[model samples]
Target: MGMHVNEVCINCDRAVADHTQKYCPNCGQPTPVHRIDWHFLGHELEHSVLHMDRGILYSLKQLMLRPGPLLRDYIEGRRGNQVKPLLLITMMSAAVVLLNRLITGGGFMDEGFSQTEAMGQALPAEALRFIAAYRSVSAWIESHFAAFTLMLLPIEALVFWLVFKRYSRLNYPEWLVVTTLLTVQTFVIWSVLVLVHRWLPQTQVLAGVLGMIYTAASLMQFFQGRPLGSTLWRTILALAIFSLASSAAVVAAVIAVMWIG
Candidate 1:
């Protein structure tokens, strides 16, 4: 038999791969294995790698310059030199998570240790104090993830649609893509929060909600370019519905993670 690489990566990019492999360690960018000295596919594989790398860079550059434009451009004829929208977003999100762990110096799950104490449990003082503290920190992050997502996303979308209503060019789904892009941005923000934690109070909880509002406002203003829309009250109601839907999605994600993984 021969060995091969799989995605549940063992190699520490600090980010955990979602699956396991026999030959390769890091799955985010995995190396192909040649078991029987087969020389074929190298050229094709190399081209694939170069193309993907270029696309990622292009996407990143676009993301930095015009966060609102990247998704729309990708949806247009301009593809291949950019990462697939969903995959790029997900991995970037995961990378931010990985980077956050590096900055924070531990996994968010470790925060679970702290919850035990809050539950009215008593234990030897020295036995697990460190673990408890670690877990507490992680648990706090875990608990806030969905709340953070819900608090900002839909309201921002509503704001976006309203601000650009006059332009009449962008619709809700278009606005939604911009909001979706924030998922990756949300990951990016997490990494920053850790660095901010060292010097200032970390307010992932508060900042996340606020950032959602800020992001929504920025996007709406960008599209609006002239003035705000009239249906402020209606937009607010729509935002509530959208946020509720997002909450349901988050709950589903958590349950799916639990049930499947």
Candidate 2:
């Protein structure tokens, strides 16, 4: 349906020769006057949260319930009615961090340090020193974890690309989008485990196991039409590669920090 054009195109400030024209000829922006009126505000409010086809709530529901199909659809150019992957992941990451802060009373770093200290002689002296430095800067890391996630996404996507390149049709950028969605889903699962830790003993272990399982299952589902055995084995290998890369990155960062210190 075309927008009801008024006197001028609010977006381009161009005079409309045809009042029935839905877009401005000069700039091609939609001609709807997005003014602050009760009717406009009400319409926006209603569609923002309750629209059945799109928005954050709808995205979240789709991601949680049918991630493989949602991602496949988005990757195949059916994305007009869906939330962008980056926006969805960023919002999810922020929500996870905020919820963790509330649940832990902002002492997450302290808890982390205590856990590291409990490791005792298992950690080398240099590693211990690194942990001390990390503890001091842990708050900064936690606050900027969303940015960290974004930075690491390409690496994760690289793992996927390498593992599935021979059989898959997706390019690196599409794989990156898939990785972003997967990462957000993992974080959401972790948030749930953290929220229910009191009732569920060993929730950390459970979360880790569940995360691996979900990753494998999601890979198989997303790579539909491939042989089941091929998908499963490739997913497992990709996950192992990603884990090693992540650990190596951490070790390199710590070594660099210790050297600089």
Candidate 3:
């Protein structure tokens, strides 16, 4: 059965070209703009949270199965079906944060750390002091994991664009979008690792290792026809650059704080 529509576009006041049209010709709003109600809210909730045909689950599956081609397609203007990259990352980060909280028994710190004290008693004097001094910042990061993770996107995108500028047609903004998608992938992987950590605490570094591999593989596949070895090396180099730059930034921040104090 066809959806009942209004005589005029409820959004744009434009005449409905056809009563059978599902959306307005002028603004693309639904022909019948239903008022907010329990049924409407319930339907919206279902679509946003549990819809599998198209949305987070679908986007995640595509990202996992063919991340390279998916990114390529999205960058090339085929994004009608996928979730917005930033929104996906935000949602994934929220999910990861929730899982981490659940696993940590509602604590801000990770598995082994005490809720009252972020650092252990056996740590060196300097290390313990540093942790104590930055306890608030650490707690903020634990709470706003998504925002904290996104703070690195600009640098990540910058490095990505610089490294692959000559090889790809994508510009800086496009690279940012690509990085956002990859970060969402990272959140998904991190969530899994959080669960795995519950079982085997020894695999602390596995998330980083797997994230790097997935990123490298995605890049290699995205830039098809490039030699895998060359692409892999370049990806590793980009990661190395990001790591060095971020480490330097942290060191500089600490030094500046110490000097100020």
Each model's number of backbone clashes? 15, 0, 0
Candidate 3: segments with Cα more than 4 A from true spot: 1-7, 45-53, 106-126, 202-204, 250-261
Off by over 4 Å in 2: 1-6, 16-30, 37-42, 106-115, 118-127, 201-208
* lDDT (CA) per prediction: 0.53, 0.76, 0.77
Model 1 scores a C-alpha lDDT of 0.53
lDDT for each residue of candidate 1 in 1-261, tens digit (9 for 90 to 100): 324333233344333334443334434444333343434466544554445446555565556556645555654546656665556555555665565566777654543344566655366654345444444444644546444544555566666577557645767766666666655565555556666766644435544565455455544444445444533333444456665765565455555444443
Better of 1 and 2 by lDDT: 2
Reference-based TM-score, model 2? 0.83
- Worst window of 10 by summed lDDT in candidate 3: 107-116
Sorted on TM-score, best first, the list reads: 3, 2, 1
Q: Rank the candidates by lDDT, best first.
A: 3, 2, 1
Error of 1 at 208 (Å): 1.3
**Model 2, 88-109: lDDT tens per residue?**
7888778767766677455333
The candidate maximizing lDDT is 3
